[model samples]
Target: MSQISVVFHSGYGHTKKVAQSIAQGATAQLIEIDNDGEISEQDWETLNQSDAIIFGSPTYMGGPSWQFKKFTDATSKIWYNRGWQDKLFGGFSVSASLNGDKQVTLILLQTLASQHGGLWVSLGQLPSSSTAATRNDYNSLGGSVGVLVQVPSDADADAIPSGDLKTAEAYGKRMLDIVNRFKK
Candidate 1:
């Protein structure tokens, strides 16, 4: 089986919950960037050995968390040697506002993967028509590049919307499928 890794940081439990769902659906390994914006040597090695990488972070100030940015900076060596060249890449993000500029966060991830010479994977899920969509509908927030999850500012992480979790899981599975197909 192709090995995949989900590298991410969660400021609150909400992002962590979504990441867990993604990992479960992908059957992928997890390498979390710590609060101090550092990853272990083992995490680095794991990322280097992965067949695919799915990035994730909570959107902060219209961008990815600083911790995830730190991890990206740490990947410069891998980028230099083309260690991740042509590998499949995907990303996901969560935020408090309905329009939290979450797209910016995904763009950052896509850029990082591109700099590594990785092949980008779109979410591959059709968005619900806003006219007909419900709050719990898949891709309700209409993200095509990556999964976007919105958790109310005051809501507990455990109370995240089911649709968002489902979207994340589906994105994970799609990423895995793309990785396996290209591995042939």
Candidate 2:
């Protein structure tokens, strides 16, 4: 079986919901980056053992939260040893607005993954850009690098749109599929 890990930081709980949906679909484990911007030692081990790592964070000020960035910085130990080299990577992000500069956050993620010498898994699903597309549509955000979502600033985790969660699930499954196929 493919071992996938979603290691994320959720500031207001909204990103946690997105991460949960993705994990459910990918059968991936959740490794949370806590409020202090730290993950446990075991979580670090899990990350090293994972076949794929899906990075997640809530976009803040047009970028990943400083907590997630802190985690990224701590990866220097792994980066020096190329511990994650060739490991598959995917990313997802959520923000309060529709165009919350999600692309920049995703780009930062991809850059981080590349710095670790990891392979990236694209979203691989067609975007929902047609006029007929609804809020319930898949990939409505048209993020090819990974899943991206938007929730109102006032919305709670449970209030996240069903469509965005669905889109996350699809990306998770697709990621797992690719990992399984390439494992042999």
Candidate 3:
């Protein structure tokens, strides 16, 4: 089976939700960027073997967490060798505020994928674009691109609404479809 790996850092579990959703849609492995800035060597091997890589992180201070940044920096060795060249790449990010400059985070991720000579995929679904659309709408554009999730800073993990989770699952399924088609 073709492989896909999602490497991510989650400060408050919101991004983790996104990662889980992506994994559910594909036969992919999930690697968490640890607090100490490490991914297992086994995961590195998995990455090397995979046909696609997806990045996820919480938008912190207008960008990704320092842990995720450090992980990205460590990829310099791979970058030098173009180890990830020709691979499919994609990303998703979550933030507390609705307008938390999440696009900046996504750009940073896309740029890194580009540096590795990878193809980037955006969230394939369209925004709801209607006044009657409610928070429960499938494609509500509350700053989510491809599985964009939003959680109030004060809300506990249990308080995360079901709509966000469903959206994330749909995004993951969509990504799987895209990767499968691209490979063909």
Q: Which is the leading candidate under TM-score?
A: 2
Residue-level error in angstroms, candidate 3, position 67: 0.3
lDDT of each: 0.89, 0.93, 0.81
Write one digit per residue (lDDT tens) for candidate 1, span 75-102. 8888899899988899999999988999
Better of 2 and 3 by TM-score: 2
Deviating ranges (above 4 Å) for candidate 3? 142-145
Task: Rank candidates, lDDT, best first.
Answer: 2, 1, 3
Distance (Å) between predicted and true CA of 140, model 2? 1.0
In model 2, the worst 10-residue window by lDDT is 154-163
Model 3's C-alpha root-mean-square deviation from the true structure amounts to 1.6
Q: Give model 2's TM-score versus the native structure.
A: 0.98
lDDT of 1 at 24: 89
Q: Arrange candidates by TM-score, highest first: which order?
A: 2, 1, 3
**If scored against the real structure, what TM-score would every candidate get?**
0.96, 0.98, 0.93
* Candidate number that wins on lDDT, 1 or 2: 2
Error of 1 at 111 (Å): 0.6
TM-score of decoy 1: 0.96
Model 3 — which ten-residue stretch has the worst lDDT? 138-147
